[model samples]
Target: MPEAPEADLAGFVRAHDPDRFLCTLFAPAAARPALFALTAFNHELARAREAASNPIAAQIRLQWWRDAVEEAAAGRPARRHEVATPLATAIGAGLLDPAALLAMIEAREAETEEDGLETEQDFVAWLRGTSGGWSAAAGRALGADPEAAEVLRALGAAYGLAGVLRSVPAHAARGRCLLPRDRLAATGLSAESVVATPHAPTVGALAAEMAAEGLEALRGARRDIPRGAVAAALPAVLAARDLMRLAAGREVPAPRGIGDRLAVTLAGLRGRV
Candidate 1:
């Protein structure tokens, strides 16, 4: 038999976002499915561009999601896709906000542009819109008031920064880099040079610098996350771990192993990062 919606969402989230998935396990049982739905929805939005064959195709997929979110927000039945079905249920239950999800979809449109991030402002905006928005929505779903949820957005952006720092070599291998041109130039690096010598000392140095910046931002944000809402914000621990690795010139973010799981669990229990 096909999986039930709750089971399907659980499996989807566990497969696509193990960090959030593990954190979701710390949530109350009644909230798990909705949280899973939110994670799944974000995953779909994230893949909208890359999953498509062309720019136009990516736009079409994003548009479809926009409409689906609007329909769900309006109390109408959403389009019958796997992610949409569960997401609509969560939105209908008032556990997730359509506007936040819409903003995330809009942010992704930038990825389709041939020219990547040009300025530091653009890079910062992308991080805020993508990861920051996601955390805000997920935070609210876990019962945080709007004020606290908004503050938690910075944690998500920190995670985004760490992700970019950790994936330097992977992105360089693809002949692309997520760092803004100005930042790269400031560090005496370029997309071409990064691609040519991904493991060079300069690349590691730049990654370390960027990771340190992200760690500082993350620490500032964590100080304000409400205790009750910390479970939803547990990804900050993983972000910190990744940022520390990048700062030490570790190319790839360390995967969650036994120790990592313990760290998140302890952080969740303590309501600290």
Candidate 2:
């Protein structure tokens, strides 16, 4: 039976990140709690800026999580919070690395401070630092070999790019444009234009370019991902699905359904994602 705290953590992930929540179901039962906690911790950090009233408040909130990680690393008690407590448990179980978690938080902090991507390299680096770091940590938690780091990084980059592309409308609505400035400039579209006219021809072209890049990354990683580590890279499947939808000009955020779960399960069984 799942512990109360673990159940709460599972519930949190289910509500905030349904894809990851479903992915956890395929992981080893013993590792499910740790995965849930780790993903929920990600949700907390990713939303810090949006949840805060101001930049300073957001930094403070992120700092709290940083402190909690440090405390756990030092063998001290972590902060008493829903995510932190279970994260501490995962840390204690040797399923999570303190430095990796800290890197994720730092990446999110940088994102909160930056306005938009300046170059393709900048965007890639951001994705590697945030989503790559998260996927790598999940790989470690799933018992992936250290040498699999590169594969996990590639998968994370692909998955991260796809997610950002799918969220264009929502991000634009909030005055945030994730497209590289150079790409936007080449297409004669500004960050404002992306949010203001998301479906414009130029914006659509830029989205397609990004989707192509993401698909290439996904293909590159698929060739190298070990069968034993595929579960950790399950998000790559959803990333592919989303990228395909974007390429087809279909709606990106489809509701989670039995079909989605079965697709993920089949992908997992084949070690394809």
lDDT of each: 0.81, 0.80
- TM for every model, in the order presented, reads 0.92, 0.92
User: By TM-score, how accurate is candidate 2?
Assistant: 0.92
Clashing pairs for model 2 are none
Q: Model 2 misses residue 77 by how many Å?
A: 1.0
Q: Work out how many backbone clashes candidate 2 has.
A: 0
Question: Which 10 residues in a row give candidate 2 its minimum summed lDDT?
Answer: 220-229
* Candidate 1 residue-wise lDDT, 141-193, digit = tens: 88888888877787888878887777777777656677888888998888778
RMSD of 1: 2.1
Predicted model with the maximum lDDT: 1
What is candidate 2's lDDT per residue for 91-190, written digit by digit as tens?
A: 9778899998998898787666656678878888888878787788888888887778657867777778888887888888776788778878888988
